[model samples]
Target: MQFLVKSARPETLKTATLVVAIGEGRKLGAAARALDAASEGTLSALLKRGDLAGKPGQTLLLQGLAGVKAERILLVGCGKERELSERSYRKVAAAALAVLKTLGGSDAALTLGELMVKGRDAYAKARLLVEVLADGGYVFDRFKGDKAEAPALTRITLLAEDTDLLACERGAAHAQAIASGMAFARDLGNLPPNLCHPSFLADEAKALAKGNKALKVEVLDEKKLKELGMGAFLAVAQGSEQPPRLIVLDYKGGKKDDAPFVLVGKGITFDTGGISLKPGLGMDEMKYDMCGAASVLGTFRALVELGLPINVVGLLACAENMPSGGATRPGDIVTTMSGQTVEILNTDAEGRLVLCDTLTYAERYKPQAVIDIATLTGACIVALGSHTSGLMGNHDGLIRQVLKAGETAADRAWQLPLFDEYQEQLDSPFADIANIGGPKAGTITAACFLSRFAKKFHWAHLDIAGTAWVSGGKDKGATGRPVPLLTQYLLDRCQ
Candidate 1:
């Protein structure tokens, strides 16, 4: 849907609908007050007629323009506006979306609810409303057909005549940047794995890096992979004819003296589990294995568009794990870039192997922080379910910051413990480390394995296994949860 900021008055506002928010039981302030003058307190009288009490998310449809100039006035409940927050905007925006969908409204202009803004002023409220509109309008429907029907809202025009539209330009720009990055992720999730292979993902990085001064993209082929001793990641890719690729994207927006923040993502285009093949049922869903990569790409897009003053780099390790004659089997030993050997006890534990070398490669930059995301283990799915991403990091302050940002962004995170006790499970009889941590702590072990590669730095690992993709009767494909979480975290750090 389209959205704009306008200065037109409510009476003169010409649109399919004009929505005004009422704080808790209080009637509308401006629009409703103007509307009440025409009715001679009839709206308040009508409330007595039905003995109706307005609360959060409540909506009352009133007709006619007595003293009011607008044809229709929508009284939306804003709860106790004084206690409202950015999160509250979601509820208010949701009510607006519901109104638009019901009225088949083509365009809407929402006044910034004064009650919702404390000392922050009207511009913040306008921006919050914009965020709410964008969020409420989001629908993951790549697989949906024409027969399916959803809310067809075309535009959301924000109105606060006195407020400077871009009062804090950074946040407003960042929001659009975030939206663009999310769009890229949605595109990747929509495509089938057949078209989004290891090479394809690598090519995407190269395309982003091509002519842009903002980033330098590099694609490392099989020769480079073997040269760098990425045998752990290569073991999973050797099974497929398509070679593995390591993608590096560099964006230097900060001062030269500033240390870069490193981001790593697992880019498995498809996973048939090599020799340890998965069941045929729901196997096609494996296409979303590259969702981690898609997120990295999304983050980069946002960083570039917002022009944030932070030097950041993103590493995507792309591979397609399949079953073939040459595929690495159970009990195979593979060497990593860190000169550590891994005993591949479970082929399904392939994501850790890919991340190990990718994290080790991060050391070259001496980054201030390193974070890796992957659809690593089903154990994480069991632990956190689909509502939240599992966060395991080395730094306490960073974890808290990320958690706070997650809450504000409405992309929740629950921190999982990373202890040394789980490290023993990775002890290999014939290798330096075992890729499979064991049966009990699958997620922890996988994280522990990746942790080994990011030594001497504040490292965080997000296992998005549970939230990466969903398959049910109506919904299927990547959910793109932590992209916003990670973006918010990055923005916080950038500050």
Candidate 2:
């Protein structure tokens, strides 16, 4: 959708829809009061008649109000004037856009950006408004034979004051980039496993680099992986006919001497739990197993779009896990690239296996910091549910940075303990470690297993299993999460 910023009177703006906020107890926001005055107490009369309660997410649509220039007016509820917050503001914007989508309007002028959200400036408000509206309009009907009709709302204009116009414009641009990145991630995650395999991801990396002078792409096939002694990664891919790939994307936008931030992703395109197969129920959602890989690519798309001056490297540990004759079985031991042996007590625990080898490889870059994203364990879902990503790391500073980034982006994470005590969960008498750390604290143990390989540099892990995608219902698809968090982190770094 096209986004524009204008510093104009709400009633004077000629658009298909004019969106304004109404707080509880019949409080009218700045734009709402102006529009109400122009319409001769139309809003007040409706409120007095109890037409709307102004509760959060409540929306009321009116057409051809007396003195308004717009064809329609959309009143979005903002629970309380003093209680309006970042989260509530997003909900209000989303509710407004959701109504706009069903209307006949092709364009809308939103004054919801003018709502006072504590600690949020005009730029932040505008950015969030665009993000929410764009996200609300997203549809994944690519595979549907009978595609649904597209929504009429195609353009959104953020009404801002003269002093805030420039900042709002910048925010709109940033949000557009982020929305593009999210759409890319969502599309990759939504693709069927049959089409979005390890090789397909490598091709996507190459495609993303095409015509982008500052970016370089490289892919390592099975032979190269074997030569590099990535036994742990290979063991996971051995069962699948689709060969494994180690895809590396380098973006050189900063000084050559500066150390880059490395991001490693577990690109298990389709995980069937290998020899320790998962139950058939809800197995279709395994296609989202590679959301970490998708998020990496998505972040790159946003970075390149913004042309941020920073050196960053993305590592995609792409592989598929299936239960085949060649699949690594229980009680098998494989030596990782770090020369640490891992016992495969449960083939289902494969994400860490791929990430361990990739993290070991990241040491070659001498990175300033490394953060790996993965759908590593189901235990993360049990602990954090679908709301937050589980975070763990060896360095407190890096962990705090990630945690703060998630907060800034509103894609929050809860830090799980990575104390030395948890390392015992992965202890194996036969090998340096065990892939499965029993059942308790599965998320922390998985991070503990990776922590051993990342000791050379400051490292953190995002276990996105819980927040990567929805499991069922009408909203069952990729959320394209933590891309906002990751992008925000990098954006903060550039400053």
Candidate 3:
């Protein structure tokens, strides 16, 4: 879809649809009141007769009313204008776009951005409008031959005055880039495991950086991983027929001398829990286990497009954990790239294995800061549910910065304690440490495992097990989370 900012009156703009805001108690916004008067009290009569009640997310459609030039008028509820918060404003915009989807139209002019949303400027409102529309229209029909045709709503013009027109345009552009990046991540996450394995992720990264001078792609195969002493990562991949790939995406957008920000992602394409198998009831959803890697690639897509002046490197630790005779069995001790040994008590806890090697590898980048995202632990789901990711870090400043970024992006993260007591949970008599840190504080212990390898630099971990994807019959898909958070963090750094 195309987004534009137009400085025109709702009655003057000729479009297939005209969207205006209506407050609770049947109060019309300035543009809505003007349009209603032009329509010869048609909206007033409907409100008087109880035909329309303005409540949040409630939309009423009027077709070809008297003296109205637009083919249709959509009045979306703003829900008590004086009490409108950012959440409510986004709800109103989303609801208006949802209603516009069902209407038969090729284009729309939205005046809803003119509505008063406390603490949000015109740019923020315009950005939200574009972002919400793009996200709502998303559909994963790639595998379906009988997919439905695209919606007719192709062009969306946000009404803004001359003073705010530039800001509106800038917001629309940023929103498009961010939404497109998220869509890219969602598509990769939603694909079947067979089609989106380690090799596929490598190819996608190479393809993404084909002609972009600002980005470079590199892939380390099993041979290179072995040469680099990535035994812990290789042990997890030994069970599968597919070779593991350590994918690296280096984006040089800032000055050459600038230290890069590093992002490491766990790319467990198909996690069957290895020797420790998961229940078969929801095994299909395991295809989304690589959402962390998807998010890294997704964020890179946005950064490259926006041409932000900041160096960023994304490392994807891609592998498939399966059950086979060659698989790393329980109690197997494997050494990592950092030269630390791990006793794998349960093979199901494999995410930390790959991440440890990658975090060790990330030290070579000489990063200013490092953040690793992973579908690491189910215990995180039990703790934070699906609303937030579990955050743990070794440094107070980095963790606080990341938590603030998550909050700003609305992709929240709840911090878990990384006290020395949690590190004690990984105690093992045989090796340097144990992969499975008992059964308590699974999330923090998992972070503790990675933290050992990341002691050389400032590091933070994001356990995205719960927020990565939704599990249900029809609503099952990747959420493309933490991309927003990571992107916001990088943006803040650039400033």
Best model per TM-score: 2
Q: For this target, which candidate reaches the highest lDDT against the unseen true structure?
A: 2
**Candidate 1 lDDT tens digits, 201-256:** 87777777677787898889999999998889899899998889999999998988
Model 1: weakest 10-residue lDDT segment is 165-174
**Per-candidate RMSD, Å:** 3.1, 1.1, 1.4
* Tens digit of per-residue lDDT, candidate 3, span 67-94: 7788988888887767578788778888
RMSD of 1: 3.1
Q: Per-prediction TM-score, please?
A: 0.89, 0.98, 0.97
lDDT tens digits by residue: candidate 2, 367-399: 999999999889999999999999999889998
For model 3 the local lDDT of residue 437 reads 84
Ranking of all predicted structures according to lDDT, beginning with the best and ending with the worst:
2, 3, 1
lDDT of 1 at 372: 88
